[model samples]
Target: MQKSLRVGQILYTNVLPVYYYFDQPKFEDRIQFIRQVPAQLNQAMAAGEIDLGPISSFSYAEHASQYVALADLSVSAKGRVGSLFLFSKKPIEQLNGAKIAFTNTSATTVNLLKIILLKFYDYEISYVTQEPVLEEMLLGADAALLIGDDAIQAKRNSHNLHVYDLGELWHQFTGYSMTFAIWALRKAAIADHHDLIAEVHASFLDSKRKTKENPAPLIDYVHTHFGGEKEEWVRYFQGLQHDFGDVQRIGLEYYYRCAAELGLLAAPTTVDLWQAGGRQTKTTLTR
Candidate 1:
């Protein structure tokens, strides 16, 4: 019997479309789904607990030497990622030197927020990581950064609080789409299970394509599980970009450049994409 590939699934509504088809029985024998937040999934991928799945862009960049990204898979947003937000008591510009709280469930957005505030806005702010409770976070800090479902809920109940969508801010600053997460396979797992990995990657691409063709099932799944109006979920899914195309690649590379400049990364890293027939390609970016 072939070993079941352990794949990580982020526990967020944004990833519903990419993973919608995998819940069927057909993938059960071949794939073992391990669901968790991006931060936990990143740790699992690094610890070799999971073979391949969507991981934070920051995690992939930090350990790019250990994994190969799927050439066609990512969780990105072109201009407005409806789920990622910064809820504040005051305006973003006035938050300089103010204490802020960050959700511990994210790795990529934490750094992205730092880049936005420190690099782009030149705000000298301090932050602490806390659970994804916007009320509690804001109780002690002037602002709270939330991503995924927590952010969506917080934004809905903001009640006069200032909300800034990070994706829109990023696009305004860099003129590029922001890729928050990418599907990555550990190099060691690839060495042994290249064929199986390829099958899983194909399934992911198929799932995404089908979701785009008919998003009703995806939205229905979210509505049933997460509890929101269909129209709102419709707009949310429409804003997300799942393909790792040229535009997203350039944006991701630019993000790496910014991260390196901010010392968030030790050095700039190449995005190594896993190709068919067990081949590999590199996308290198320089200053």
Candidate 2:
């Protein structure tokens, strides 16, 4: 018999479709949801604490051998994922060597920022926790990376902060969408129930129909799931974009190339994505 599935998810607002899925009695018992921040989610997955979860794309590349991406989901906008913010009291260039505040909330975004800053921006800044206070970052640092709700809240400040959205930044640099989170599974576990991966992707598409039209129901679902402030979560979900779009999406290529450039992967290649009707075969990355 197949083992019961354990699922993990980040508590971010972009995951409403997955949350709404629990409404279906078909999946409720078999699939258990582990509500956690992205950073913790990835660690748990790496440590084998959970079998499946929406892992940050960076982790997929970092720990490629351990996990295989099951379904494409939780991507950032091409030109604007407002939730990812790079705030600086000083300019990026000016902050040569400083302590940068990082939201330890997400591994992918944190690593992405680190790579971008080190490789492209030439910023030699160390990452510090977002807690204790923003005041700490302000006093002892050059900039801060605040993501999700924290980023949203920081953006509202009256102070002048240079906010560089990673999606927009990557699009301007590479002309491709940034996929933030991907549904990933333990590679060993995928052999027997690969069909279930397809089903989950199908399920995401079906839920999108109900969610794509009206924002209220999805928002309500988020509020119920996380016990968060409803109106804000609704507006945030309304702003997010979630179309995996037939598998030939530009985001996958961007991921491959970036991974290669970082020497995380040997080469770049197209991902052979599968839609609802068939079992998806894994695509090797080659340039």
Candidate 3:
């Protein structure tokens, strides 16, 4: 008998649409789910604790040599990602030499913030990583960057302070959608468990399709578990882009280029997208 594949799942509500149906009976015996925040999941993926799952795009880029991305799955946003925010005591323009506190729960957004500040905005800023507590983060720094549920709640209760959506900022800076996370499969796992990986990828695609056809169940789940208004959850789901198609690929490649130029990555790497038939295609950087 083939062993169950270890799959990583992000604990944030933004990923619900893709994973909403993963608890179904078909997946129960074939898959084992490991839930964690993006940062932890990144570590797990790197440490070989999980075979495949969605990881920070930056994490995928950094280890592009060891993994291949699923061509049809991603966590992205075109203009405004409702849950990724940078709350500031002052306008973003005036924070040239300011201190910014970042949530320790993220890897992609942390580096993306650096790219935005140092590369795009030409600001030389210092940063510290702290727990995802906005008020506490703000006490010690001029601004705080928060992602996932923490950012959502912070923005909801926010007043007077300026809240900048990182997705929006990225879209404005570059005319491409921003892909925050990608589904990555370890190369060793793919070599050993090709059939299982294909089945899991199909399950992910099916779940996303089902969610897009009827999002009411997902919204209700978020409302019951996460305790937010259904309308807000509705808008949040609507704003997110889940497909890793041409647009998302372009955006991710551009992000890799920018990150490499900023010294966040050792060098630009090809986006090796996994194909179901045990073949992978390398997407060379356009620049």
Candidate 4:
């Protein structure tokens, strides 16, 4: 008997490539994935709304035991990740007294921004999650964490605002890949539908390739989620690459190390995603 595995994904342009299930009838019937912002997706995963999808790295750490990570699969760039951003109406130091807005889309970026504030700038700022608009937060908070399309448009300041790049922040702090999210599965789901996980991953990869060859199907989806320049969004989708291999471990470890350094987690554990626990032997990317 075959059962569809429920999966969850974030609502960002960079993540659209993973939704290839929409076009594949075979995987579609077997997939019960929901598209939501990272934080919401994390909640869905924790609540058993879906088995797995790309999730915020911080959320994974918070509930490490509940899920197993597809270590090779993640959203991270070596440098210059143009999506995540931190903006303030004043200098980072001056931002201490001002109101700032944070995006509610991702749990990981929130903490990631906090690390930059506490460590790099030496600012004891009050962090709050208010709807992200310069007017809404600048009216009351000191700084804001903006991500995805909201970050894209809002962070582009006219010279008065100070922007602290989260990707660059992580690069400066840890020399490995700064993983934002990875395909994650509920711990129990792996026990029953392990093979389906691989198949779905393959399906996702195939979709990514198809989108890369012709992004027309997702252009609107990408433009809507990414927000800034249409060409920039198009270019972003062109650059996304998903791997199901060890290339992601360093980044995963780096994320955990950074979280640990910030006292976010006590001792983090790494998943041998090659075998992914419960599985019998190491399976290389045959997809």
Candidate 5:
């Protein structure tokens, strides 16, 4: 019997379209799946708890020495992702020096929010990390940052708060897609089990393809598990870009550059996407 590879997954509605159906017995046996939020997964990957999963892009940079990105797989958006937002009592410009509570479950969105505020708007704000409850996060703070399912739910219930989609803000400022998460594997794991890594990568790609072909599985999933209107679930998946193609690569590189300049990252990191057969490949493209 082949050794099973442990995988981490983000337990959110958005990821359902990419990974939901794989829960069937066929794929489950080979994959020892551990579900977690992005932040926890990031920490787990760095600590060698999970071999590979979709991790926050910012955390990837912080742990660049330990991981290599899985090519052609990412959670990104051109604009208005509808799942990562800053809800504020006042406009962004008016909130200088105001306290903003961010979701402790994310790293990419927190850095993205800071990059948008400091680089584009020239605004400064203090931040506190908290659990992603819109009401609880908004208490004692002028703004609250929410991501994934919490953000979508908050958008539905919010009437008076100013909601700024971080994806849209990044695109408006930089004209590139905002890559929130990337599939990353530990360097040593990939080195030790190239074939297993390839199998895992193909499994994710196949899952994503099947989900896109028939969205009913995902819609039904959110309806049964999350309790939402089917159409709303459909729209949420429609807003996501799961492939890290050339355009998305440029967007990701631009994001890294901006994050490095803003001191969110130690330095601008290279996009060394993983390849089958234990090869580490870096693609160069002109933006």
Candidate 6:
């Protein structure tokens, strides 16, 4: 029997469409899907606990040498992603030097928030990682960064809290879409299953196609499994994007550039993109 593929999946609603098919009994023999938050999945991929899955964009930069981008899929947004929000009692300008608690469940959004504050908003603030409880995070701090399902829930119950969509903020700061997460495969794992790459890639693409073709099933699944009004969930899904095309690639590269400038990495690393046709491309970069 062939070895089962170990796949990591982010439990965020934004990614459920891609993960929908994996839950079916047909895929059980071929794969083992591990659901986790973005940060935890990143750590798992880095530690080789899982073979491949969507990972935080910032974490990919930090671990670029360890994995390869599985082109054609990502969790991105043009603007106002709804799940990545910065809630504050005061305006962003007034929050300079303020204590802000960010969810430890994410790394990309935290870094992006810092970039927004320093580069665009032009101020330095103190940030600490904390549990993703909006109320608790804002108890002693001026603001809190909540993301994924927790952030969505916070928005639903937002009473007097100033909410800023990080996706819109990133777009306004830089005229480009934000690629929040990318499906990355462990290099060694992929190499071991080189002959099966095309089959695996096609399966995922088919799943995404099925998801887009008829969103009713997905929305129903979300409502049943995740709990949200159908109308609200529809709008939320509409705002999210998963195409890893040129536009998203440019945006991701720009993100890496900003990360590099912030000293997050020594320099922008090459994106090893696995093309849809099962070909590999080494994307070179400078600055």
lDDT of 1 by residue, 121-217 (tens): 9999988999999999989999999999999988878998999999999999999999999999999898678888877787788888889999988
Worst 10 residues of 1 by lDDT: 21-30
TM-score for candidate 3, please give it.
0.97
Q: Give the TM-score of candidate 5.
A: 0.94
> Clash number for model 4?
9
For each candidate, what is the lDDT?
Answer: 0.90, 0.67, 0.90, 0.68, 0.85, 0.85
lDDT of 3 by residue, 144-209 (tens): 999999999889898999999999999999988989999999998876788888878887888899
Pick the lDDT winner: 3
Worst 10 residues of 5 by lDDT: 20-29
> For candidate 6, lDDT tens digit of each residue in 1-287?
76878888898888877767643465556778789999999999999998888999889989988888887889999887979999999887688789999999999899899888988887878878899999889988999999999998888888998899999999997878888999998888876676556566667777888898989999998888777699989989899998887778888788888878989778886678987565788875432
lDDT score, candidate 4, position 245: 48
Candidate 4 lDDT tens digits, 1-287:
76778877676767766664345568657777577888888888888878878888788878877777764567766555677877666666575544446777777778777666667666666667777676576667655677876777765562576777787777776665566777776877876887787777666766767766777768876566545567876666554455544555666665666668878778664653524333532223211
Cα misplacement distance, residue 244 of candidate 6 (Å): 0.5
Q: What TM-scores do the predictions have?
A: 0.96, 0.80, 0.97, 0.82, 0.94, 0.94
Model 3 scores a C-alpha lDDT of 0.90
**Collision pairs in model 4:** 6-51, 98-141, 98-142, 99-141, 99-142, 100-141, 100-142, 100-143, 101-144
Off by over 4 Å in 5: 1-3, 27-29
* Per-candidate clashes, comma-separated: 0, 1, 0, 9, 0, 0
Tens digit per residue, CA lDDT, model 5, 2-75: 66778889988776656865534665666688899999999999999899999998899898888898877899
